[model samples]
Target: MMLWITIKVALRSLWANRMRSILAMLGIIIGVGAVIFVLSLVAAAKADMMGRITAMGTNLLVVSPGQRGTGGVMSGTQQNLTADDAEALLAKIPQIRDLAPVVRGNVQAKRLAKNSRTSLMGTTVTYFPIRSFEVEKGRLFNDADCDAMSRVAVIGATTATNLFGTEEPCNQVIKLNSINFRVIGVLKSKGDQGWFNPDDQVLVPYTVAMKQIVGVDHLNEIDIRANNEADLDTIMDRATKLLRKRHHLQEDQDNDFSIRNQAEMLKTADSMNQVLALLAGGIASISLLVGGIGIMNIMLVTVTERTREIGVRKAIGAKNGDILRQFLIEAVVMSGSGGAIGVLSGFVLAAILSRVTSLQASVSLFSVALGLGFSMGVGVFFGFYPASRAARLDPIEALRYE
Candidate 1:
């Protein structure tokens, strides 16, 4: 049909000025590439963080020590959580599947002149299931150890390597805070999580940790797992009220503890990631506007250069729509090709960034679709004015211009 002929003519015109066409598309290329790269990196990071947070536990709620008021004056954080509070919550709240009272501190670990200052996690056996911890070597300490205040410890992979080197860590005695403790197990590696490395800590009974290691009777925090995801909010509310009543806090006074849930953490993470993507993607998309302008400028010059051709075709009965469609197709072809090349470049750049840098990057299908859609839209939007101008030109005036 005539439309196919017009497309061929547009292609021929672009090919005749290949260098100019490429230059016109360069802006689109960079703009789309930048958008893909930034958004992909953001997606990867959000996924990584959410994975780590979930790794800590699912349907989880953590109660940490919070501020309290003394003599009608606000005071700093107090040790307001205890094993009794944990027990009471489990007994009273039917939605609570399991709970772990945790106490942690920094301790110097030693084994035959090898020493490292690492974090200490003191909790009961339930802590493992609640926090998704699995033992790699030997066995986890049981309720008997906690009841007996046994000095058995579960060392993380990093701690094992640092303390005992290639020698077996399980059954080996290591000194923690100058006290001998037998290593009962070694935990599987959880990697360095940026904020804190879970693979670099020692685990022992909360009873022993309180009486001997940390020397504090109050728990540092209590972790609770709900019966299911649906019960998260209900459990959080009920636990908060129960704790307040247990502590005998008046309406005017603040409770001496704070509770947080995985759902809230997820929501906050999503919001933060959205803001990050918006800011970064917004900055990169500006180049697309610049590219559209370039395409419009080139199309305008093209209209002028082909004025006589346009007049000749018009005299031969080529319609105004034909001229407009031809020019518009030319701009679209240019921008569309640029978009394809840009997507490839963005994927390559994202892969490179993920490898050579600390940032995790992954090109999602959504990003590809978005980049392509935006590029093609630029083509139609910016190509319209010049196409319209070419269509409206008088055949006589165009013929006289040459």
Candidate 2:
């Protein structure tokens, strides 16, 4: 009966001050909306990053000249990787299914009246499988081509279009650094990656790149793909040892090479997503706190205006718990309503975000539940003191108030 009376009183009070009640709830709405929007956006970005990483290949590993660290691709000063390292890895790491040592450079290409600039990459034919590349129209370089140091090239989709226009590029001759080469193949389309376009590349045999283009014996990186994902650790260990021995490194010396797997990439992406979500949640919590203060302030004003009603009820045998419950419930109702509105608003905001940005936006149900729960908790925490003070008022003094 007491609980029922509290509910009734709370509903009636809010109904009597509809505009003020709405005003109090708006703070919570904004807070919850912000939390949901920020979290969903961050989650989308993490998902995209993970997808791109995985799309490269399931059993793939990246080997660079130096150890991975905080600074990124330029983190390590060592540049010790070479074609020999790739050959040794292939010969020794039995679990390795395929490997490619890559040498990269920037160059200009022209065919007849067409001219365009693109990146030149040198690698073995196995790079197609190790990097999960599919040929769109023409064939990739074979082992014979790599051995002969052939003056032949394969073009990416974007590179083909940019240089040849509507012309069928296969069997055509293109000039690279004023040297003539036959375009024997074109890579199939791969969409724009956030950082670079694979379709904007021109591929030649690693030997050609070393002898004709960059004129360097060293490689930019080595790409490896294991026979199975379970073999990743074993293959990585074998490759690292082989490289260290070739370089004649002391046992106490740190490794001058780095090997990266899919797991590390996924973990790093998850950490970034978590940190972004936490920061957004912190900012949203502040808004909820401010909303709670609004509830408390309004409730105090309510207590002052209803002092005579409280005195009459207390004199008629109403208990302090009843009055306290009434005020508390009112605060909760306001905040709860605000939370619902905020969640709906957040979904709308997420949709808008997706349309505007490249990031994928997904509305998670947990965010809704979390937001609503937070809002109600805020109401209870801030409303308690004000509710208790109203309940503790002296009946004689309340009755005598003018």
Candidate 3:
């Protein structure tokens, strides 16, 4: 009953100066909203990254040529990886289930009246299963085509649409860099992984790409698939040893190639995202602190304005604890209401961002709870001093004032 009375008094006091209470709450509204918005966006981005990583395939490893140096002066990448190196790893490493030597180039593709400039990936038939790609239409080129250096190409879904429009691209002849090639297959859509759109490139046999398209015998990268997740590290070590032996590196020499595991890369990406999220959240939280200070300033002014009312209540035999509770409850109500409004605004903002941009925003219950809890905590921390000061006033002195 006493709690209800205190709350009623608090509400009545706030209602008396409606404009002042609203102004005080504005800071909290913006602060909480900003925090929720930034955190939600970060969470969405992290989720998207993880999804793309999972789609790449399990127990996967990638090999790329390392940088070359001449007398302590660093040069560009060493073009040393070749199709022969890929064959060597497959033959020597028992842990490797499959491997694909990849070479790539940028070329202009034309068919009929349409033309599109895109990347050309030269890989073998084993590339599809190793990278979790599927042939949606027609058939993928076989090992025979790769061995024979056939000028057959498989187009990505976006590439198909770009070069052929609504026309069926399968079995159609598309000219790549003025070299006529038959499109034997169209790949299913894989969407975009950050800036790299898997659906925007064309795939061809590595032999053909090296001989006619890219005109280089060296491979750009190698994709390796382990028999199981547990064998990934073993495969990496075996591949490194085999490559070292094949490349004729001395005992004291550094590796001329780099091996990267998909799981480790995903973990590193997640860690970086976490750091970004914390930094963004931390910067936004400064506004919450500012909001807390605003609450303290307003509560101080409120205490001064209601000094005569405090004296009247004390004259009626109200205890210091009762005076403190009333003022503290008023502060809490202001901030709590502001937090509710902020939470709603945050959700709306998140929805707007999802609709307007490529960014995916998802609001979790944890964020909402944290925002509200922080706002109330701010009210309690900043409201105490003013409440205590009001309670400490001398009843005689307060009543004597006009």
Assess every candidate by TM-score: 0.73, 0.78, 0.82
Q: 1 or 2: which has the higher TM-score?
A: 2
Error (Å) of candidate 2 at residue 397 is 4.3
**Largest lDDT belongs to which candidate?**
1
Off by over 4 Å in 3: 1-23, 67-76, 111-115, 317-326, 347-365, 384-402
> Order of all candidates by TM-score, from best down to worst?
3, 2, 1
TM-score of 3: 0.82
Model 3 clash count equals 0
* Model 3 per-residue lDDT tens digits across residues 264-296: 888888888889888867865787778888888
Give lDDT tens digits, candidate 1, residues 1-402.
766776677777668888988899899999889889889988887888899888877789999998667776867669878899999999999999999999999999999899999999999999998888899999999989999999999999999999988999989999999999999999998777665899999999999999999999899899999889899889989998999999999998776898988877788888988998898777767899999999899989989998998899799997899888878887787787778878999999999999986668989899899989899889899999998999999999988887
lDDT of 3: 0.88
For model 2, residues 48-112, the per-residue Cα lDDT tens digits are 87887788888988888775455456555466788888888888888999889999998789888
The segments of candidate 1 whose C-alpha lies over 4 angstroms from its true place after superposition are: 1-3, 12-20, 34-59, 66-79, 91-97, 104-120, 143-152, 158-167, 171-182, 191-197, 207-220, 226-238, 252-256, 297-325, 344-366, 384-402
lDDT of each: 0.89, 0.86, 0.88
